[model samples]
Target: MAKYLRNLTCTALFSMTLPMTAAAEESEVQDMSDPLAVYTQAGLGYTDKGINVKVGQTYDTGSDTSMGMNVLEIKGFAGEALGWNGRGADDSIDSIRFRNFTVDLTNGLGGQVDISWDFDSNQGSASYSFIQALPKMGMFNFYHSLDLG
Candidate 1:
């Protein structure tokens, strides 16, 4: 509430102190008519949910432990990526994700997957974790794969 009040006060003060501009200059600020703006923000590359696609080959060694032998597998998916901003100081919002992921069992890690994200103004005490059943690690149950901030 205090922050809201402060912002409101500042906006009101700015409006009152702004110097008057010529009519021709004022006319230059045209209202945007882009219909998509109604759905997303003023300028953005992705919609409420950005897109991500991955396709990779998975080959299981004969000794996968309790899971036993496995065949060649491929995984691909698409999900919502709504809360990230590239322009401002504050951009990452909260989101929920549900999907199936795989970790390769191949030696020397035949493939590499790189996932990147950015956060601004870190004020919240949040904990993030990724869980997966690792056939590569010889585990039949899901376990903490990684921890994120």
Candidate 2:
């Protein structure tokens, strides 16, 4: 009877050690840099009982930093004004545009501007524009950042 008990204890101990050894061998560390980790968003909103469409995409360059572009469409009593903004490692904004929906609408809007940034101080600035047709108005454009650490 004692010999059988000893054999059972040995078997249980051996089984437990096997799983620990396997887990240690399977452990690994991976890099967080992935260009395909981009994010996208699209939605629709009501403007004085009309429909307003919005779409945007953001790309992360790793190290808690990212860039993005946004396109908005406003349709209602008002026409529409489409705009775009982008950011980089230094948190600087550039290449802004605004235009009228009825005039040369195909080319969209075009403009050039620069945003101030402080890398060491971790601060930046953003801007916005809008278009109005009546009781309905379309305004879009902004920049924001956060610190994960």
lDDT of 1 by residue, 1-149 (tens): 67456545543443242222223345355322311111112111222223222222223334442111111111111112222232332223323222222333332112122233222232333344443433334433233446554
Best candidate (score: TM-score): 2
Query: On a 0 to 100 scale, what is the lDDT of residue 59 in model 1?
Result: 31
Compared with the true structure, all predictions reach lDDT values of: 0.28, 0.29
What TM-score, to 2 decimals, does candidate 2 have?
0.23
lDDT over C-alpha atoms for residue 44 of model 2: 47
Task: Please list the residue runs of candidate 1 whose C-alpha ends up more than 4 Å from where it truly belongs after superposition.
Answer: 1-46, 66-149
lDDT comparing candidate 2 with the true structure: 0.29
lDDT computed for candidate 1: 0.28
How many Å off is the CA of 51 in candidate 2? 0.9
